[model samples]
Target: MAETDVISIDAAQQLATAALIANRTAPDIAARVASALVASEAAGQPGHGLSRVPSYSAQAQSGKVDGFARPSLERVTGSLVRVDGAFGFAYPALDLALDALPEMARGNGIAMAAVRRSHHFGQGGLHCERLADQGLVALVFGNAPKSIAPWGAKEPLFGTNPIAFAAPVPGSASLVIDLAVSRVAKGKIMAAEKAGRPIPEGWALDRDGNPTTDAAAAMEGTMLPIGDAKGAALAMMVEVMAAALVGSSFGFEASGLFSGEGDPPNLGQTIIAIDPGLSSGGTYGERIAALMTAMAGAEGARLPGSRRIGARLKAEREGMEVPRLILDEVRKLAGGQSLSRLD
Candidate 1:
């Protein structure tokens, strides 16, 4: 087995900074992007963390992801809006959508925004949590390039298609549920491949349609859904709402994020925010607080989002620990000094 090395969060941040600089991303955008990646690591979602830096930088340098593209918004109604990401980083586009959500939800009791032509937005739960922080309930969904296969099929048909929900709990932490509908995300396959390790069986199939533990072969095949057909059905729903609903690419029609050529991936995301107080007659906050108290009061009962919140708090207080191999790759991609020198 290969050895694992851990490094502090500051080193991870510096590596991401170097990658962004090498990719020609602006300092402000680079910092925000780096923060998101590090936060993913802090939250224990390494698949979405700094491991993605090299690929992201390569995309930016190859012009597959424009570093300077700014998103433009089109407000359709008091509660409905659309944003064109203009091929920029999805983080900025999601930030713009969150910024507009409060006023829209306050005005109409609910707000929905469709994002088109965006890149990967990291953890969907983070987007929902941002709205929950403002005392609103949020649902977020996104569609990516094809990786998972439809039921009874051997070829890839849909992206992992993640969905997230968050609701404010008044005096306590927000309740958040975020998950990819597939058995696992494609990034995990990539991670396993990077580590030259075999993935668990049932995670994916080989090119010949046989279930395999080989990460590289699985990448050539298709990913399985979480609950057989159910997850695939949910993925289709998300694809319609996030991609078709937003007038963006869907399924195999979507550009490959790893191709590094052709048109941008043009991924799509949907965000919905609701002001519960408007419908609950001022009792929504109290109700949520009561439920949270009851759940926490129960023996061995932990609330949703608590784990990530606790992890984030610990990371904030004592700093995050990241895998040194990921850092080394980032440095090499950024043209910085090699890890051998530090060793």
Candidate 2:
């Protein structure tokens, strides 16, 4: 066994890919999903990282997720696309959106893609950053498994829906903003539960509608909204934009994220891409630079996603660590292969 958990990035992806393949995921799709999970790890978002593999593999093996599902896309218009994930993991569906977005944006000035029958969208920023890399501004919205309540209610009616936006920053990294509608993402709470830790107050209320510091209780209860009623309203808006408008299941109708007990989440996501020049002629970058410059000058002002981007840089050089237990579990899923052999 490796003495330290500090694993190379390649090893992480390879381990994840092998585990997905063992669970019956198609080779290509498994690789894509693995890479996305590894990318999540690189971005300092462990909640969406490799820790997801055991549940994902279990779901795939149990037939709760169609490991071989082929995502299909249809253009409803020059500027709009509809994608069906065929009940697969969401990364492949997102790959379809990312692949199609730039060309559609160039042709139509703006383009939108609606994805349904999907699974968890690991991280919004990565999806948006891809389009931004193509010199277009992008927005990504995803509805997750339900873990939040409507304002003034105890029912978990909405997912901790996340939204992300990105734009090229001229000669620098893209400006990206990704956020969950809840006060804190439910994944963080789940991670805490796995680590056997208590959650902070104000993060959630137990099923009886009372606050609890227990992580497991928080998972069984309602996640507090970020800005109270405002976040609830935003979550409702996402329920409409990503689910109702896309013909996908509402958060309340979806199964639990960590379980294979019910139907597939059959969730929805929306991605919008726009050519910067469409709205700004040729001065979009200049306008953005001015705003960024001003923001840089403002006291205590820091750009959103700065720390996330920084972590990516760090992960690239120093790689990252995967707990020995997680690595062992995934390796076992991958035919009980040794890490040395798997890598």
Candidate 3:
């Protein structure tokens, strides 16, 4: 096992923020990104946590991500909002959208936000959960750089798009469902490679389209989709909803996100918030509660976000155990040490 260091969440965020600022990210933007990364870590998603600092910093230094860029928003209709990320990190843009969306949904009973020219918006479930906390049902779709191929062909064409949904229950924690179209997120393979570990065979296929257990090989190849064709179909759906609809580059057109060598990914994200009171007429809470009760009664049925919630609570109380290597790298960045390579 890798040697790990336990760090308080606030301290981790401080380190991340300092590292980002040293790498040319604006202070405000750095803070937002740091907060999101830390939150993802607390939720047991290390792939999107501190591990991302090196690449993100490298991207900022390379100008692939405009560290100083600020997002702008527009209300196109009574229930439609459009945000331009201006080639910046996605956290600020998403925060801008969320700040306006809840009120819009409450007023119009349904509100949709389309974000363009954005970078990665980590852990989409968190976004939905925020809406659910506001007494709204929320859905989010995001498309990334191409990493998955259509079911029939070998050449990669679709991203491992993610879909997230969240809904509130009368007096309980919101239910959040988040899934990646790929059998597993490519980040996991990247993490394994960093740790010199082999990935599971079924997770990815080599360049020749044969399944492989080598993490390095998996990174160079295409990811397997969940439910075979069905997952691929879902990726397409996200592409249309997020990229096509929002005038962002298609997955095939975007650059790789893990490197600082190419152009900005120019990804897109679409968020929809619905006021359940409008449709359910006060019965939504009761219905959701009943469903929850039924699931709780099942022998071993675990709620979708239950584990994540538990992880968050534990992290809050005991801090996070971050890999020592990763922590050292972030510390170096925070200390203004430049990395020769982000990989």
Clashes of each: 0, 0, 0
Candidate 3 C-alpha lDDT tens digits along 1-343: 5678899998888889889988989887888899999999999888788888888999999999999999999999989999999999998999889999999998998999999999988889999999999999999999988989998989999999999999988788999998899998887777677666788879999989899999889889999999999999999999999999999999999998887889999999999999998888878878888899999999978888788988999999999998888898899888853322221
Task: Report the lDDT of model 1 for residue 310.
Answer: 77
Q: Report how far residue 32 has shifted in candidate 1, in Å.
A: 1.6
Give the alpha carbon lDDT tens digit for every residue of 45-95 in model 1.
Answer: 777888788778878888889887888998998899899999988998888
Task: Report how far off residue 106 is in candidate 1 (Å).
Answer: 1.1
Model 2 residue pairs with clashes:
none
Spell out the clash pairs found in candidate 1.
none
TM-score of each: 0.92, 0.95, 0.96
Worst 10 residues of 1 by lDDT: 334-343
Please give the distance, in angstroms, between residue 183's alpha carbon in candidate 1 and its true position after superposition: 1.2
Better of 1 and 2 by lDDT: 2
List residue ranges in candidate 3 displaced over 4 A. Answer: 336-343
lDDT of 3: 0.90
